[model samples]
Each structure stands twice: as structure tokens, then as C-alpha cells.
Target: MAFRPAQYAALLLGALTLSACARSPAENPQERSVIQNEDPFVAAMDEATNAAAAADRSARKTPSKPQQSDAPRVDTTAPKLSPAELRQRILRLTAGLQSAADTEAERVSRFLGVSFTPELMSIREGESIGDLEQVGSYRVSVSRIDRTAPGKHVRISFGPAGFSTGRPSICTFELAEFADALRSQGYDAGEVHLPHREQWGFVRYVSASDLTFYVSAELYRANDGTRSGKLCLADVTADAVKGRQ
Candidate 1:
């Protein structure tokens, strides 16, 4: 029997629709498992996770301790100068004074009636260098001379002098000016110098040696540049000189 063309077309369309309907809506469990386990993308993802964990571990590593710096230590020892040692220093200093006087005998004779001598001078312990007070005013003090000079040019202690309460402003005056000022104030004064940061000045006073006088002064420059002068007055004697009177 001969088939009709319209019936054949309808029959093919129906078959195509049926075939599409019959197709599975879900994938096979075994096949999907194989794809997930075997795919390079999955393997690469696992490798990336492991690499991240390793990097985290590396970042969490403990740091090393810092090294300590090397620096110099400061010295804090007080100087040791005993009575004997100080006496020796005084002897040496007096000898220098005698030599200086001998070198300028004529000048010494004119300025001071007597020359320098060793037996006429000595150093005694008076007080430690510290603060000073005078006329109800406080000052930083160093040392005090209990004796007097033996000649015109004397070796005076320069290491010990104290600062006045009114510091720097009063201290900046020239040594000569200071000496002049002290003299004006009725204090025996002389040439002044900074022997060792401590202010020291030379003073001249009447001596027992008949028409002779000794010269020595000790002064201190305060941190503020102010100065304090201490004059030592003595009478020059031929055999034994009178100490500070």
C-alpha cells in the first residue's frame, strides 16, 4: 500500500518529540564521580590548597631575636689625694714658685720686698671643695687656703673654688677686672686666671718681713659665669712668714 507524504511528516515529528522526552534529566553517579576525581582542574585545585597551607605555615614561622648594641661604659671613680700626696704636691708647687721668684729677683724685690722660700710655706687641710656662704649669701665652694704665700709669685691652688649664688652674669668679667673689683671692695686681690676651670686669683698683702707682702688669691667661676674671690692675707717674714691672718 502507498504511504501519504503528510502522514509521514507528522509521524517523524512525533518520534522526535518522544525521543527528546525519553532522554535522562540527571547524570550517572559513577560517571560524575570519575570526572570529579580524574579531571586536571580538580587535581590542580587540591594542589593549590596544599600550596596555600604551606605558605601560611612559612608565614607563621617564629622571628629571630634582635642583637644587643655594644657601647662604652662611663667612669665614676673619685680622685684619691691623701694628706701625704697633697703635701708632696704643695712642695713641688712651692719649689716652682721659688724658681720663678729667683728668675725675676729684681722684679720680685720691687713688687714684693722678699723673695720666695720653701721653709716659709706649707699646705694644710682646710676644707673640701663644696658650696660657700658669705654675708648671708650662699655659693658653690671648692677649697680654702689656711696658709699664705711665701713669695711674690706663688703657686696657688686652682682646683678648688666655689660658685656664687648669682652665677654666670657676675662671672664673665675679665680676671683683671675681678681683681680690681675685689680690691675696691676692700679685699686684697691680684691677677686672676682659670687654672683648671676653677677660678683662681693672686693677692698681695702686708707681710711680717718688714716692708714685704705676699701675693695669692683663690677664686671660682660658677657655672653661670659668675665669680667668687677669696683673698689670703699674710705678713712676709724673713725666717718664718705669717699665714693668712
Candidate 2:
């Protein structure tokens, strides 16, 4: 798994993807032959926003009794949290160390009764470490404190699990509403790295100050016609600001 931006389909994580030296299959043991032999992490992200259906198959088999614990839990994906609240939560999830940082990730882990592996899992290429856990509705992939560059960063991505069958726990977020929420909180309008459809019509990638979110054009069209969608993939990294507009 060579750590490079061109390798990934989208605008790869600014410093996380391409900064590291070339890597090997040993570095990505969990790697699987996916669409276009594309990186599973990236593919997982692209597929997150997709509402299309998959081939009918047998359901996934999970442990009967998984990580059971009496811990307070919260699903940040749920639309319940105000975008402003979710912003703070994104900060909380990536705040400390691994599971020890244990704010949102721990809540998700505890709620699903699935604990992160003791050993760090290589995610989104390079050695940007984190955990991989799957439960009933969603697949959870998160990066540990990103030490590759200087910043408080966490890359989190969630997609509907293969076994999922329209689970209510899945967060169904409308892009416009969520974006507006962040904007109201003083976040910028967003910098488009890759715009789909037309010029600023819809964006595949957008960054605001220290925050960046990637989505498809279907969420909001050129005429500002918004659609019903949820945030399937998101990379939340809090880094230094290059001054403000």
C-alpha cells in the first residue's frame, strides 16, 4: 500500500495519505481485492454516500455476545446532535488517544458492544493508525491521534454494513441542513477541492478552515435544489488555520 494521493480516488487526506514513504502488502495485511483493486479504505468511503443497493446475499454473521459493558454511549451520526454539537463531538472523538480518548468513539464502541482492537489497525494507507469495528448497522473506521503531521486530527468513516437492512440507528443527514448548521456556527462556506456537476453546483470535496467533509453532488444541486441524503463518509481533522477570510 503505497501512501500517495493519486492512488486514492478522491482528494486524499492532505498529509496523511501521501506523506509516508512507500509501503508493502505487509503494511496492509487486511487489504482485499475490491472495485478496481482500489484501496478498501477509500472505496469504503466512496461507497458510504452511495444509496444504491447491493446484490442480494446472505446476512452477516456476528458474535452472539460481543463487547458488553455498562458504559454511557452516544451515536454522533444520529441527527439528534446539532451540527454545532456534532462539531464539538468530532473534536471530542479525536481528542485524546485511542480508545482511551473514549468520548464519541468509546460511546459508539460501548453502544455497539464492539471494542477496538488492542493493536492499531492501519487505515486509509500509510501508518495512520486506528481501529476497524463492525456491528449491526454501520462499519466504523477511525484514525488514532494523527501524529504524521502536527495537528489534532481523526479520520472517521462509516458506511452501511453489508448485513444492514435499513437500521434506524444509521444517521440520515441532509447535507444542506448539516452544512448550514456548521456555517451558522462561524465555519466558512467551504473550499472546493473537487467540484462535480458544474462550477460550484455540487462538490465532491469541500474544506472549511480546519474541517473538511466529502460528499456527492446528489445532496445539493447547482440551483440549490437539495436532496435527501446522509453523511456516509467524513474525515474530521483539526489543524492550524492559515488565517481567516
Candidate 3:
């Protein structure tokens, strides 16, 4: 029996629906084509998108070589001051001492060219300079031009004095002189003092500039008359004075 046109058309539509439902996922050419064309659509989205992705990759990548930081730099090669300028700087630093004793001390210290904080002077008188246990003794003198334009004299006795004879003398001096004296003597020194007091420590002199120097001495003692000492010298300059002050 021959099918009518309407029946044949209906049968054809049913067959198409059944085939579509039963088709394997791999056989879906339209779906596969959509996936295959996806890359082109993404690439054509915009020129900026590709450029931005490249830039991102570049930013995330590390440089094979070391890179310099954008920090401030110091200029270490500037011309230094002349001798005259250095002398002026020294004079400016020493100008503040008004006492005759202080002036002489400062002048001599400057002549030694040693940088120091300040002279700590202590003196004591006892039955014997050695009677004080753990004390040290040394002689110090200074010469300077006075306000009256005359040469002035200043002298000091340095070392550990008997507490009973006088108060313990303590003062801070410049580190430059202390270091210089140590270096001159071929002795290595550190900024820190020894944990225990030393006896007979003496600083002869330190050179700071052509005209400057620093000198110092220290003495340590025990209750049983045991004594030890230390000495320091330093060169004082404008920079040293500024740093200390």
C-alpha cells in the first residue's frame, strides 16, 4: 500500500526527531563547529584584550638579572673642604668655652686634633696618692691663648682618686680621640669600655687635623690596692664636633 503525502511527511518528521535524540555527542557537527570557532571569537574580542594579556604575562615574569631599587642615592664623590675651611670649622666648635681652665683644655684638645665629648676631670688628695685602693694617677697640662692675648696654663691630675679623699670624677670625652690613640699605639679598640674598670689607662694624643688633637687617661683600682689603667687619643674635626654636639 502506498502512503499518502501527508502521512509520508509526518513519518519523515518523526524519523528526524528520533535521529536527533539518539545521535552520539561526537556526531554533533554543529556543536563541534561551535567549539572549534570559539578561539577565533575570543581572539577577535578586541586588540586591547590580547595586548593586556601579554602585558600581564610580562609583569608577572621575573627579570633574570638584578634590578636596582628606586631609592635615593648618596653622592660620595663630592670635593672635600680645603685646609682653611677645616680650620674654620674647628675654631667654630671650640669657640664656646669661656672659662680659662676650660679654654685651655679645649685649645690643647683641639691642637691635639682629637675629637672628644668633654674632659671629665677629677682630683683627690689623700695621705698618699697610692693609698687609695684601685686608683690611678697621672699628670696632665695644657697651654692656650687667653682672652687677654696671653699664653695661659692649665693642669689636671687624672686617675682614680680615693672616694674618701674626693668624689669619683666622671666625664665623657670624644670617641675620635679615644679611637685615634688606640690606633696609634697599634692597639685595637672598640667604642665600648671594658666591663671591669682598668688601671693606668692613658691616652697620649690623637690627630684630627693638622692643628687638632685629643688626649685622655683613665685608672681603675680595687679595694685591695690593685690598679689598672687605659689611655685614649683622638683627632677632632668639624664633622666630629657636630656629631658629638
Best by lDDT: 2
Worst 10 residues of 1 by lDDT: 135-144
Quote the lDDT for 81 in model 3. Answer: 35
* Residues 64-124, model 3: lDDT tens digits: 6665767553322212333233323333434423333333444544542332232233211
For all predicted structures, in order, the TM-scores are: 0.20, 0.33, 0.18
Candidate 3 off by > 4 Å: 1-155, 158-209, 223-245
lDDT of each: 0.32, 0.33, 0.32
TM-score of structure candidate 3: 0.18
Kindly indicate the candidate among 2 and 3 with the higher TM-score.
Answer: 2
Q: What value of lDDT does candidate 3 attain over all alpha carbons?
A: 0.32
Tens digit of lDDT per residue, candidate 2, span 57-162? 2223433566578766333343333333443444333332222233234454443333444223443211112222322222233343345432222333333243
Best by TM-score: 2
4-68, model 1: which lDDT tens digit per residue? Answer: 33432332344335435432222777765576587767556657878999988886795756769
lDDT measured at residue 195 in model 1 versus the true structure, 0 to 100: 26
lDDT of 2: 0.33
Ranking by TM-score: 2, 1, 3
On TM-score, the stronger of 1 and 2 is 2
